[model samples]
Target chain A: MSGYWAGILSILAINIIFAYGIFIPVASGQLNLGGAGFQAVGAYSAGWLSASFGLPVSVTIAFGVIVTGVIGVLIAFPILRTKGVYLVLATFAFAEVIAGAILSSEPLGGAMGISVPGYIDWYVSVIFAGLVTVFVFYLMATRFGLTIRAIHDDEDVSDLMGVSVRNVKVAAFGIGAALTGLSGGLYAHSFSYIEIQGFNALVSIYVLLYVLLGGTQTAWGPLVGATFFTLLPEALRSVLPATKNFLVTLFGETGIVAPPDESWRFVILGALTVLMMVFRPEGLVTRTMVERLQFWRPANRGVTQ
Target chain B: MLLLQQFVNSIMLGSVYVTVAVAFTLTIGILNFLNFTIPTLFMIAGMMGWALSYYGLPLGLSGPLPWPIALMGAVVLTIIASLIVERFTFRYLKTKYGDSTEHAIPLVSSLGFLLVLENLVRIGYGTDSRRFEGPDADLTMNIGGIFVRVPQLVSLAVTVVIVLGLTMMIKHSRIGRGLRAIAENPDAANILGVDTRRIVPVVFILTGLLCGLAGALFAINYGEVSPAMGEDIGTKAIAGMVIGGLGSIWGAVLGGLIVGLIEMMTVHFFGADTVQVMVWGALLLTLLAYPSGLLGHNTIGKGKL
Candidate 1:
């Protein structure tokens, strides 16, 4: 495949992992926005370890995932203490701190970021994506999943019902972080490079968006959200060359005016988000709702309605 | 002296955050949750004023005055933006999900908005920071070997005056008492005929206007405005609100001032880069230890969301 096709696949692959990375916590009634931070640590750890210690790619990836899982477990302590917006804030802060450290610290390769030789390929990323898809699907149907939903609906009631809210939250966080770390490791190798921007807070937002806009109810919501977003703008660029900058800038930081990629992009985009939430908070392609979660009949067409 | 200057600068930075925390607290308290895209109103208003100025619109071309008048014009524009966020985020979330599931949706949609808003600025203003040299006064002076710039000093005073005035207004004024009633219990306020629907948008517009004003003041104090400035400051504001105690108007104000001062003291005592992030980490620890913060709301420990 050409670099463009390969690039698209890699992007999709990473996003799929990211989508699931967010989905695990969110589905369990916890919204963790520190995916990119965990991902970055995993990526950098794997990158640095492989390069410096001459460890095999698989070993470094495993170690990176384990270490990040431990960090996730640590984070869960405070996260479990707070409810709602506070939890999101804690996770967001954690991610920001990690990103800041990555940017300023010299041993972490400073702002330039260390480059890594190709240790993973499109196949590896695709396989990981499959693993996430299968695992989440399976996990969402289990008894533990019911408890997670219970926690999501109401923490106090769940606790009253004998659910270990703290432990479950921690477990969910560890799982999410592990997936993110693995994805990050793959991402570092896929790009053959890593930088501060790779796991900045914005990436966390993007992953959250992927879960939300895709329709967090079923297995397919995140995948669709990630795939569509990752590709739609890129595909539009190739088909409509003149309007590509306009469309992309219309999405990113700069907006469409004169150069079409001006700073107003976010200002208007923010307004548009308000529009989307008001008009269609459910998402473009929602999950087919099946209250039973069985392999039985799929009732609702989308996740929301 | 350089150390002290950076410390002072951080406090100056904190003033803007104080305003933001106040605005955020005011809005959330009234509505219980926000639509997410609201934060962008701050950036959009300031950027609009900048855009108008860039287009050679006279400072007060909206009327027969100066830049401050234009800034108010921007505030009016942001009031519209707040309504927009309301109609979009709230209208749908309320319609589809009810009040309970509203938490994650707004923030996610806002993330989408943030991207668009920041990018709009980047594309419109060329990704580089825009130099905004507002009218300068020779008010900057040295206090105990610490130089406080005129704008910074003015911003500090303005923030204090605004916070104090608003606090008093909220605590004593008819509307203030009504808002307090509504915030304490929207259902009760509604039963007592508070006209919550009216109050919700009013609160949003009021907070948005404050945010716009703060953003303009921020532009003046910082000498340059960048698209990226809002994220970190916005985070700090959230932290301030969390630390000071959510929904406590006085707490928010005090929290902002404390955060500002701590930041300054840290920078003064330690190196700028080292102290800056350390302050956040320290603040997080303090808040965690205290749980609700200096004067924080009670629900943070509940873990309900």
Candidate 2:
């Protein structure tokens, strides 16, 4: 493949992994807006391990994911204590704390950021993304996934049904953190650099948006959402310029007629978000939609067997 | 003396945070909606103010107006944008499914608006910061060995007045009572003749007004405006709002000031790079220790995810 397509595919793969990392907790009735914090932990850990200790790529990646998972479990107790807007604010703060710590830590290269020695080909990311996707799909098919969905539908009812709400939430959060970490490690290795700036609050917001906009009701949400958003700018990269040219032709002469692709993409994203919430707040790949796609009967939608 | 000066400066900075935090707390309090668009509204006011001042009104309506008119125009535009946000996000809160993540719909849509508005501003103007030629940016006064900018003092006074007025409005007025009822229970309030549709937009109006004023003050005092200006201040305001308690007005005031103090002190002691860590760490600690925040009622955001 050409370098351009390779770059886009790699990014697409990383984003998919990251989105799933967020999807797990969200699916379990918790909003993990701290995805970037966990990802930063994973990326920086990989970078630091490879740079300082001369660790291999596999070791660094594993260590990064493990560390983030542990941290996720540790923080989940406090973070999950709050619900709704409070939960969102807490996670958002967590990401900022992580970014701030990295920015000030000398060992992490501070503001200048760190460069990684371990480099991975684009295919590595794609393979990892596919494995992660399958793993999440498999997870959602299990009894554990049912418990999560149960909690997501109604936490009080899930608790009454003896679903171990706390444990399920923590588990989902930790696993999500690990997956996010894996993506971050891939990002670090693929880009051959890791910076604190890359893990800012916007990254967390965008990842959360991807999962929510895709649909939190089913496993298909993250996949479709991530793929669409990852490819959106590239699609716009072609269409926006043409539209701008058309505008120029119609208007004849205007000041500064360059294509406003950067801004247009976000405007489109925002507009879609608004429209989706209004028309399909359940998201694009909701449970009913997924079941319909699977050709399942309406009564069997929530049944295990 | 220098320390005292820092204190005064911190309070001035806190005033901006106070305004924005009040805006945040109000929406979360009354509407139970975490309106992320507040920051964008803040940015919009400042950037549009800059655009109007620098480039004149669009379509050759008039030459670049005076500073006062530009700022007023900015605030008016922000209110309009906020109403537009209300139309999309809050209007769709009541859904048939009644899922756990239903409440997140408005929150997510606001995030979309954040992206849209910020990027739109970036597209209209360049992403770089623009010099805002407001009323005497360098105008300062020395009070008891501490230096204070005239515009900063004016903003601080204005913020105090507006917040106090808002508090009274929410406490004593019939509309205030209706808002409180909605905060208690939207459906009950609607049934009780609170006019949910009409009163709800009032929250957005107040949010827009507060954010717009803060943005204008920021531009006038700092003599700079940028498309990205809102993210930093907005996040800090969120931290303040959470710290003060989500639904409490006075709590936001104290929280905003406290955040400002923390920010200034962190810059003084730990250097500028660690400010994010300190502020966010404080927020994390607060959420863990006192989830309701310093003055938040336990019932405000206790809804299920």
Candidate 3:
């Protein structure tokens, strides 16, 4: 593969894993906005372990996943106490705190960032992404997933129906964190470097957007969302300049014919997000849409279930 | 005396935070929606003001206007942008499914707007920071051996007056009563004769006014404007909003000031690198330990997303 394609594939794989990490919590009715924090914990832990202790890649990645999972569970208890906007704010604050802590810690290399010794190629991350996708799908098919869905539908009613809302939420959050950590570890190894700036609030927001816009209904959502959004910029890279050239040709000569800015990609994404919410707030791949595709039942076209 | 000067400086910084925090708190408080575009709105005012003053109106409409006029034009543009955001996000909030994550639609759309507006600005104006040619921000006054920037003092007073005015308007005006009713219960207020659509736009208007004013003040005080300016101040404002407790104006005020104080003190003692850690750490602690905040009502922001 060309270097460009390889780079794109690696990013696509990492984003898919990261999206699922966020997807697990959102599916369980929790908006884990501090995704970058968990991912950072995973990446930095793996980086530090490899750089400082010279641990093997496998062990360090495992350590990263476990440590991030544990921290997620620890943070989940207190954070889950607040619901809705407070919950979102709490998670955001948690990420900022993690970033802040990472940036200031000396052994972690602070703002200088740490470099990992162990390196991995694109295939490794792709394999991990595939595994995580299957795992999440399997998870969603189990009784535990049913309980999470129940809790997501209505917490109090689920509680009345004998569901342990708190435990399920914490479990989902932890699993999501672990998955996000795994992706981060892969990112560090794949890129061969890790920095705090790479995992800022914007990354969290983008990952969450992938999950939310993809459809939180099923595991398919994140897969589709991640792939589409990840490739979108690459697609636009050629399209934007061509469109600008076309405009310039059509308009002859004018000051308005300035070269297209790279930021147009984000602008397009943002516009799509706004339009999607207006026309299809439920997301692009919803439960009903998935069901219709599977069953091919014309009568069930508009029926939700 | 140096500590005292730091304290005063913190207050000046806090004034900006307080304005933005109130803008954030107001939306969350009344509409029960966390508008992510707020920071973008703030940035718009500053960047637009700079653009207008430095380059005049786009397309040679006129020569560069005076700074104050430019700021006024920027504030007006920001209000229009806020209204545009409201039309898209808030207006389309309702979903037929009514699932737990239904509330996230507006939030997600606002995130889209955040990305769109901010990046559009980046495209229109280059990514680099520009010097804002405003009144001399260095004019200082010495009182008891403590130095205070004259512009900072004026801006601080303006912030105080605006907050007081907003509080009084929310407390005593008919519109305020309607807003309070809507905040208490949107459907109930609608049933009782409050125009949900009309009153909702009012919140966005106020949000734009507050954010624009804050952004203008920041430009004058800091003497620089940039596309990325909002991310730092916006996140800090969010921390202030949470620390003060979501949905409480007074809580936001206290929270903004507390955040400013923490930021200045951290810079004084631990260097600027640790400020993020301290401010975010304080926010995380507040969310975990006292979600209701100092002056916030416990019920606000607890609604399921």
Candidate 4:
């Protein structure tokens, strides 16, 4: 159960990082779905280095972040040439490559993944999540943030306005990817083991969902979304009858009962995203909250619908 | 000689990509959002087929499907699941909060649905992959030493037929013209008396059926299915869709096949491990350089050179 609590906290921290990672690119109007890919690189880097090289967990994490960050820059250099949806496709492809690489790269444990030292705890996760959120909030307030927002609104105009559209997008990708890598490092440090299976494209989608569910505008959306989303299912699992009354009740009463037994989390999440996009693109929190917190507003408030 | 075998293999995989990408293109074009559930649909089809087979209910016993006798029993089952998502999740959100620029909530909620579906399948069936049975099972036939299997051949034929038929319908059929009109200009299409709302459900049903059919074929072709299948297949399809340039149905088909061939060629030339994915990353970079997608109209942001 304590492990569960730790899992919950780690989920929160990872979600925070995931949300911010997505937000930074999105703030500039790019919907890159490759955070999970960067996280995979970082996770594998930390796991492999710590396992084979006997590096300190902290040093391995740093190495992992730096390595993934560099990879992010390399990828960004080519892909950011496209805008909006094209960027999303590029990142999604990037994540898939990472997943396949992890699955095939045996020295890094391939599909089996690798084990690393455990140095992160609940307190550490909480502190990291908080600090990262605060840092991102501040970063979005500066000139750099304003430019990203401007790009998000209108890339051509922003480019004309002297915003280095390409540079800023690349910066967003690199920074967002760094956060994903950091989360991977923390994940390795907390669990002492890592696998491609764990840090998969699905996790990337989950991170995106948490950020979206929490409302991407508010800096705290990731934290709130991660904490609630991760714990909710586990809690539901515990409450369900052994005979699987839960599925019946969930579908009948709530009309969203996940299929019994196998984790219906993916189906549930995917479906929810469609529904949410159609109905409330803003999430539970209003966009005004994000606008009011201008520093956290990676782009201009007036331009956003 | 080996190259010829790989080409066939590539085409077979490319057909699958075509199916999934077509579904995604329709949704994205109409709804103004990328319903990531497209992947889940692929997964669900596999799970459904797996569950039926696991219960000793072979395709022979199931009768030729489309199982219209029971709406939820056949291909229509996918439509039911999709509608459930649209109604409960998307409808609820749309009712609660109107569409805004923020993508966090909808994306996350839909993601939650995806997770739920995945986990439910996992709970019902174990994480291990399962073999497909009956008419859908693998049957090898050596055609000039290429060794075409039942699943692959059947799927390819079905794909060609479906694509051709659908293309005809879209180009000349009454509903097809409207769908195209809507895709071309939604407001204009609506003003011209195209019932966009009615078309939405029809499109969902059509796309879901494709996924379900293709999914079933994939299981039978490989003789094995896994929960992770969706993520991998979806990633490649996404790359195909982008590289071909989204929107045009033909674009998705061509894109999927090209990507499939590229993946196979890479695998044939490079070690089997790196081939399929390495090209995806590189191709994504290539597509990004174009920004209009391989064939899209133009970059959305007007930052074009």
Candidate 5:
């Protein structure tokens, strides 16, 4: 593969894993806006372990995942006490704190960032992404996933029905954090460097956007959302300049046309998000749409809600 | 003596945060929607002010106007942008799935607006920071060995007056009563003839005004404007809003000032690198231990989103 294609694939895989990490919590009725925090924990820990202790790649990645998962569970108990906007704010604050701490910590290399010794091929991340996708799908099919769905539908009623809402939320969040960590570890190895700046608030926002816009209704949402959004920029890269050229010619402008700015891709992404919310707030791949595609199965057989 | 100087400087910095925090608190307080586009609106005012003064109107409509007029024009532009954001984000918040995550539609949409507006600005103007040619911000007054910048003091007074005016407006006006009713219960307020649509836009307009004023003040005080300027100030203000508590104007004021104080003190004690850690750490602790904030009502941001 060309370096460009390989780079794009790696990013696509990382984003998919990251999207699922966020999707798990959203599917369980919580908005984990602190995604970048968890991811950063994973990346930075893996980077630190590899750079400082010279740990093997797999062990470092595992440590990253486990540490982030433990932290997620520990924080989830207190953070989940608030719901809705407070929950969102709490998660956001958590990410900012992580970023800030990482930026200031000396051993972690602070603002200088840490470089990892281990390097991984693009296919490794791709394989991990596939495994994660299957894992989430299987998770969604289990009794635990049913409980999560129940709580997502109505927490008070789910509580009345004897569902352990708090436990389910914390479990989902921990699992999500772990997956996010895994993605971050992969990102560090794949890129061969990790920096705090790479995992800012906007990264959290974008991943959350992918899950939310993809549809929080089913496991298919993040896969489609991540794939589409990750590729959208690359697609736009070619399309935007062409369109600009066409526009310049159409307008009969004799002056030299400046090359298209890179910001247009985000503009399109943002426009898509706004339009999607207006026309299909339920997301692009909703439950009904999925059910409709399964023509062989009886329509009412699995309609839980 | 130096500590006292830092305190005064923090108050000035906090004044800008106070304005933006009020804008953030007002929307969440009344509409129960977290509008992410706020920071972008704040940036718009500053960037627009700079653009208007430096380059005049787009397409050379006229020569560069005076700084004050340019800033006023920027504020007006921001108000219009806020209204447009309201039309797209809040107006389309319809619950189709009747799920907990459905409440996030507007929030998600606002995130979309944030991306769109921010990127468009980046495209229209380069990402580099620009010197804002405003009134001299360096003229200082010495009081008891503490130096105070004159522009910052003026901005501080303006912020105080604006916040006080907003408080009175929300407390005593018929519109304020309507807003309170809506915040209490949107459907009930609609049933009571509150004109939900009309009242909703009022929140956005106020948001625009507050953010615009804050942005303009920031430009004059800091003497710089950039596409990415909003991200730092916006996040800090959010920390202030949360520290003060969501959905409470007074809480936001206290939170904003507290954040500013923390920021300045962190810079004084631990150097500039640790400010983010201190501010966000304070926010995280507040969210975990006291989600209602110091002055916020308990029920404001607790509903399921």
Candidate 6:
């Protein structure tokens, strides 16, 4: 594959992993706007481990995931105490704190950022993404995932049914954090550089948007959401200028038409998000939709959801 | 004396946060939805104002306009944009799934708008910060050994007046009653003859007005405007809103001021790099220790996700 395709694929892989990282918490009905913070922790951990100790890529990436997972567990106790909008804001604040601490810590290179000593090929990340996708699918099929969905549907009812709401939320949050960290570690190794700026609040917002747009009802949501959005800009790159040229030619305007604005992709994304929420607030996919796709399996339809 | 100067400057800075935070608290309080496009609306006013004054209207429709007129035009544009946001986000919020993320429909849509609007502004105007040509920003007054910028003082006064007026309207006006009814229960409010369709837009209008005014004041006081300016201010305002407690206007005012002071002090004592950590850390702590915030109603946002 060409470098361009490799670059896009690598990014897509990382984003898919990251999107699932967020999808776990969101799937349980928590809006984790602090995704970038957890990601930064993971990235910095790998970057620091490789740079400081000359660690191998696997070791550093593993260390990154473990450390972020531990941090997630520690933070989740207090964070899960809040709900709804407050929960969202708390996560957002947590991410900002992480970014800020990294930015100010001299050992982390402060604002200068850090370059990783370890490097990984795009295929490594792609493989990781595939494994993660399978893992999430397996997870959603389990009893724990059922409880999570139960809690998501109605917390009071879930609690009344004897589900440990706190434990489930915390576990989901920690696991989500770990996955996000893994993605970050891969990102560090793939790019060979890490910067606090890349993990700003907007990153968190974008990831959350991906998951939400995908539909939090099932494991497929993040995959579809992330894939569509990550590739949308590339699709627009080819399509927008042509459409602009077509319009210009059709109008026979004498003035020079500027190339299509790069912002149109996001505008379309925003518009789609709005329309989707209005028309199909369950997201691009639904349990029924998934069931219908498996039309031959009428026996399995009763179990879906 | 130096300390006193920082305090005065902090108050001036806090006024901007106060305005934005109030807008935030208002939406969360009334609609139970965290309106993410608020910052975008704020930016729209500032960037559009700058564009109107520097580059004239879109597509060569007109030459550079006067500063005040430009600001007015910007506010109008923001209000219109806000109404559009309401159409996409608020109007179609009720979802069929009745799942955990149902509450997030509007919030997610708002995030969509946030990306769309902010990027569109970036595409229309370059991403660089530009000096806003307003009435002389240099005008200052000496008060008890501290120098205060006249524009900042005026802006602060304006914020106070607006807040007080808003409080009165919410407390006494028929519209205020309608809004409160909706906040208590949208269905009951509708049953009681409150115009859900009509009054919901009022919240957006108020949100637009507050954000627009804050953006204008920020431009006049700081003498700089950028497409990205709102992100920082908006986040800080969120910190303020949380500190003061969501759904409490007075709390937002106090929270905004306190955050402003904390930010200035962090900058003064710990250097600029630590402000993010300090502010966000404070927010995290608050979310843990006092999830309801300093003055937040215990019942607000306490429901399941």
| Candidate with more favorable, higher TM-score: 2 or 4 | 2
**Runs with alpha carbons beyond 4 Å of true place in candidate 3:** A253-259, A295-305
* Cα lDDT over the full model 2: 0.90
- DockQ scores of all models, one per candidate: 0.43, 0.77, 0.81, 0.39, 0.87, 0.77
* lDDT tens per residue, model 1, B145-170: 88778877787898889888887888
Question: What is candidate 5's CA lDDT for residue A60?
Answer: 94
For candidate 6, write residues B1-305 as lDDT tens digits: 88888998899889999999999999999989888899889999998888899988888999999999999998999899999999988886676656678878888888888988898888877789999999966787887778988888889999999999999999999999999999999999999999999999999999999999999888888889998899999999999999999899999999999999999999999899899999889888898899888999978876533
| Candidate 3 pairs with clashing backbones | none
lDDT of 5 by residue, B170-287 (tens): 8999999999999999999999899998898999999999999998999999999999999999999999998888898988999999999999998999899999889988888888
lDDT-best of 1 and 6: 6
Could you give the candidate ranking by DockQ, starting with the highest? 5, 3, 6, 2, 1, 4
Which is superior by DockQ, 3 or 4? 3
Q: A1-305, model 2: which lDDT tens digit per residue?
A: 99999999999999999999999999987888888999999999999999999899999999999999999999998889888888888898898899998999999999999999999999999999999999999999999999999998889999999889999999999999999999999999999998888898888988998999899988899999999988998999899988888888897876666666477898898889888888888888977676667754667546899
**After superposition, candidate 5 runs with Cα above 4 Å error:** A251-257, A299-305
Best by DockQ: 5
lDDT of 4 by residue, B1-305 (tens): 99899998899889999998888766655554466677888888877766654553454675433311222343456767777666554444432322223433434455666777777777767788876554534478988788888768878998889888887988899998888777666679989999877876677777788888778767767767888789778877777777676666677788889889988898778767786467577656666566555555552322210
> Candidate 1: which docking quality band?
acceptable
lDDT of 6 by residue, A220-285 (tens): 999999999999999999999889989888988766777877888888988888788788888787
| Candidate 2 residue lDDT tens string, B50-125 | 9999888999989998999999999999899889989888876666767678878888888888888788877778
Error of 1 at A112 (Å): 2.0
lDDT of 5 by residue, A217-247 (tens): 8999999999999999999888887888899
lDDT of each: 0.72, 0.90, 0.92, 0.70, 0.92, 0.91
